[model samples]
Target: MSFHQEPAVYADLVSLNVKNLKNSIEFYTKVIGFKVVNETEQEANLSADGKTTILQLRKADHDRTNNRYTGLYHLALLLPSREDLALITMHLASNRVPLGSADHHVSEALYLEDIDGNGIEIYVDRDADKWIWNGSNVHMVTERLDAEDLLKDQPDPKDFTGLPADTIMGHVHLHVNNIEEAEKFYIDGLGFQVVSKFSDQALFMSTESYHHHVAANVWNGTSASSPKDGTVGLNYYRLVFPNKEILDQTVLRLNELSYETKDMGAYIEVIDPAGNHIHLVSQNAQN
Candidate 1:
C-alpha cells in the first residue's frame, strides 16, 4: 500500500555532495581513518575500514541555496569485522582528527567531520546482549575509548590494515528541533522501529533490530529551527532506494502522509517541528 507504511529497511548508501571533493576525501581517509573505496573527478567513495561504502563527496557551489548551517552531525559508519576497528584506531592517532572518541556501553565510536563540515563517526557494534537499556533510553556511556590498547593489541600494521568487507554507514544524525515530532515521522510515519528514545530531547531509531541507524536532535539549543540559506552546511542526505519500486512507494507514502515530495519525484521532504529540511533521495549509483 505504502512504501514506508511497512518497515522500509535501509538498503544501501549512494553518496553525498560537498563543495570540495578532494578535501573531503582526505579528511575521511587520513583524518577520520577510512579507506578510499573509489573516486572520480566529481565524487569519491569512502568506507571506515573497507567493509561497506560510507560516503560519496560531490562538488557543488557554495551558495545560499544549500548552505543551511546543517553541519551533518557525523553519520556513523559501523566497522564490519571487529579487527576493522583496530585499523581505524591506529590511523586516527597517526593522522589526528580531534580524537573525540568514546566507548559507550552499547558501542565504541570515533568521530570526525569533512572539510565541508559534514560529521562522520566510525564505530563497531557491541553484542545486543551487552546493551543496557533504561526504559526506552539506551544507556550509552561517554567513557574514553582507549586508542592505545586497541592498537597495541593489534600491534603490527601488517596484521590489521587497509580495507575490509565490514564497513557500513551505521547511523545518521541531523540537526533538528522537536525530538517528539521527529520521532513520530521516523517511527510511526516512516515505519522504523523506535529502538531507543530520548523523546523531545534526542532520538535513536532503526529499520532492523540492530539498535539505531538514525538520530536527530535540536541544533544550537534552538527550541524551534528553520535553517537559513546562509547557515552554510548540511546539504542533503542520500538514502539508497533499493529500486524504483521502493522509491516510488516512498514517494507515495510520504505524499499520503502530507509531506512534500519534490524534484519531479527525485526526493521526499518532511519538516520536523524545528523546520529543518530533511530529504529522502533516489539516484543511480553512477549519478
Candidate 2:
C-alpha cells in the first residue's frame, strides 16, 4: 500500500498503562521534569512545556505482560534545550532514580523505565542542519555523558516547572527481529520514506525528511524473532492523517497493493511487518 507521500510527521505523544499512576507521575516530574497540565477523573496528562502532552496515564497494574500486546521500548521525549537536559539530570541524580544516559551523536538522551517496565527516554536534539548524511543515511554515534559538567551548570528544578505539552515526541526507538522485514512493512506498507539505513543493520525511516521517525534495529533478537510476548514492546504505530482526502487516498492505495484494511471514522488501518497495526487517522470535514 502507498500514501500520497504525505509530509513527514513527528510523533505527537504516546499513552501508556502505568501500574502506579501517582508513582509514575512523581517519577516523571521529579526525575524527568514533566509537569501536570490536566486530569480527567481517571487519567492525568503530563506536559513537557505547556503545548505538548507527553503522557496519558491509564491507571493499571505494573504489567510484565507488555510483550503480548507489545509494550513500550522507550518514548523519546525532546526537551527545549541543553539546560533543560541539565536540570533534568540533576533531578534524577538527586532523587536517585535508576537511569541510563547516552549521547547519540544526533542527540543527548537519558533512559528510564516506569513501574511497569515501559522504557522512557528524555532527550534533546542537535540542530537539524547539523545532521550529517550520506546518501540520505544519517551518521549517528554513541558517547559517554558528562553528568558532572551538566549538573554543574544545571538550572533550578523550578525553572522547568509547569506543563510540558510544548515538548514534542522527538522519535521512538524500537527493538524488532528483522530490519529488512520491518522496512518492507513500515516503509512499503505504511509509506514512510527511507531516511537512513545502517547498511543492513538498522533502518531509520520518516515521512518527509527529519532524521528518523522510527528506528527499528536488532537489539535482542538473537532468536530470530521478537523478544517474546509480554516483552516485545511497541506493538503498532497510530498515524493520524491530516484530512479525509488523504485517508481516502490511502485506502485506494492499500487496495492497489492488495492489502486488507479497515476503515475507521476519519481514519484507516493496515498491518505492518510484524503484523503490528498502523492506524491512519483523519478528521471529518464538518467535525
Candidate 3:
C-alpha cells in the first residue's frame, strides 16, 4: 500500500508567510531546487515538479519575525530515494549552505532553515519492514549521519538539476502550547493514531502505520503563544483524505468534540489546539 495515496491521510502542501517574496523566490529556486509554478508581486507557488505546488510563499504584511512563537517547527520533504538525498546534500554543500543532519533510525534527514527562518527538512525513509517497533511506539533514534560514506560515489554536480518531481511533503512538525490538548485535537478529533512519543514533550501521529504524518512538540516553551497577526510563519498546511466520506466523518468527529470547522466547498478549514491552520480535503475534491 502506498503511504501517500488512498487509505492513508498524508500531508501534501504547506503555505508560509515569507518576509520578502523576491528573496524567498531566489532561495527556494537556487538553493532548494524548486520551480516557480506561478507568482504575483506578493506571493509565489513553488513546485518540485513543474505542475503541482508543494509549497507556497506569501509576502508578509508586517516585518515582524516570530522566533519563539507556536507555529511551524519544520516541514519535512520526503525524497524518493537515498541517492536523491545525497544529490541534494552535495548540491547544498557545494553552495556553502549550512546544514545539520541526523540518522533517525527510521530515516536519514538533512535540516536547514530558509531565508525567513522557517525550518525545512529533506529526508529519505528506510524500508517500513526494517523499522523497529516497540509495542505501539516506533523506536526512533537520532545519531550521527555518515555523510562521507553516503556520498562515496559522489553524484556529478552537473546532473543535479532540481528536486525530483516525486518529492513529497512528507510530514509537518509543529510547536504547540500543550501536548495533551494538541493530542486531543489531532488523535481524537482527526482520527489519527499515536505512533511515537518523546516522553511528554513530543508526539508523533499518523493515519496508517507509516511513522508520522503530523507531530507536535513544546520546544518553544509551554507558555509559547501563537504567532501574532501578520507575522512571518505558517499560513496553513493541507491534509488529504482518500474520499469525501472519510473527510465528512472527520468533520463530524471534530464537531462532536466542539472544535470549530469551516466548510469551504472544496476543502474544510480547521485550526488545531495550537494556532496552526489546517486544510482538510478529499483527494478527489482537490484541484
Candidate 4:
C-alpha cells in the first residue's frame, strides 16, 4: 500500500548524526513520543508507528552540531490530529520541556530540540481549503500560538503513549548558504514548484500544491559552508517522488546540468550546491 499518497512528493525520513546515542534516543522516544522502530550499535530508527521510519539517529564521533554550519534548520513532524498535538503540548508542559510555539497560519506548531541540538517541530496542519493562496505563493505567518485556545478542545485526556499511527515527517527545512542556489537545485534540478518565497532569504518548494515539502533559507549567511563529515547534524533526507518516470527525468535533468549524483540501486543521491545531500526515491519503490 502507498503511504500518504496525497502529497505525491514528500519526505520519507530524516537521518541525523548525534554525539550520544542513548540520550538522543531517549529524548525522541520519551519526550517526543516516537516509537523506537529498530536500534543497532551505531544508529537508531524511530517512528510514530511500527512500520514507517520517520527519524534516524546515528552515533557520531564529532562534537555537537555547529550552528554556523549550513545544515538542518528543523524537521517538522506532522501529527494525525489537533488532539494529538494538544496531548503533546500537555506532555511537554508537564515534563517542563522547553517549547517555541507558533501558529504559521497553515499549521499549529510546537518546536523544541533534542539532546544533540537538532531542532524538532511537532505540528498539525489546518484544513487544506483553509490555507490561503495568492497565485503560486501561499500566505504563511509566524505568530505566537494561542496555548489556551489550542488546549481547550482536547478530548483525548489519556496518557501519551506515543504519536498516532498516521503521524508523518511533514517537511524538512534547511539552512543553506544561498536561496537562489537552493531554488536552482530543488526547483530546476529536482522538479519541485516554488510555492512561496521570502525574498532572497528563504524559499518554500513543493509538488502537488501542498504548501511546502522542502524549504531552505540563508539565515546562516551566504558564506556558511557545509558541515564537516561526522559532525552532529543532518546527514541526508529522503525525497520520495510520485513515480519512477519523474525520478528518471529529475536525474537526467541534474546530469545535463553537470551535477554529480550517485545511483544507489533503488534511489539516486544528489548533493546540492550548499552541500546538503538528498536521496531521491520513487514512491512505487516503497512497496
Winning candidate number (TM-score): 3
Model 4 residue 264 lDDT score: 87
lDDT of each: 0.61, 0.63, 0.91, 0.86
lDDT of 3 at 157: 63
Candidate 2 C-alpha lDDT tens digits along 1-287:
11112344445556655656688777667666677777664567777664445566756533443243323457777776777788777666566778898877777888888666778888877887777877766777778877777678656765645424446677766666677777776666666778777767677877656666777666545244433322323434455555667667776777776778987654466765444445566632211
Highest-lDDT candidate = 3
For residues 97-207, write the lDDT of model 1, one tens digit per residue: 565688877788877666765666778877877777665566765798877766676645444455455566666787665676677677655656676666466677766
Off by over 4 Å in 3: none
**Candidate 4 Cα misplacement greater than 4 A, ranges:** 1-7, 154-158
Give the clash total for candidate 4: 0
If both were scored by lDDT, which would come out higher, candidate 1 or candidate 2?
2
The better-scoring model by lDDT among 3 and 4 is: 3
TM-score of each: 0.75, 0.78, 0.97, 0.95
- For model 4 the TM-score comes to 0.95
lDDT of 4 by residue, 63-116 (tens): 754478888999999888888889989888888899999999999999998887
On a 0 to 100 scale, what is the lDDT of residue 176 in model 1?
68
Residue pairs with backbone atoms closer than 3 Å in model 4 (clashes) = none
Cα lDDT over the full model 3: 0.91
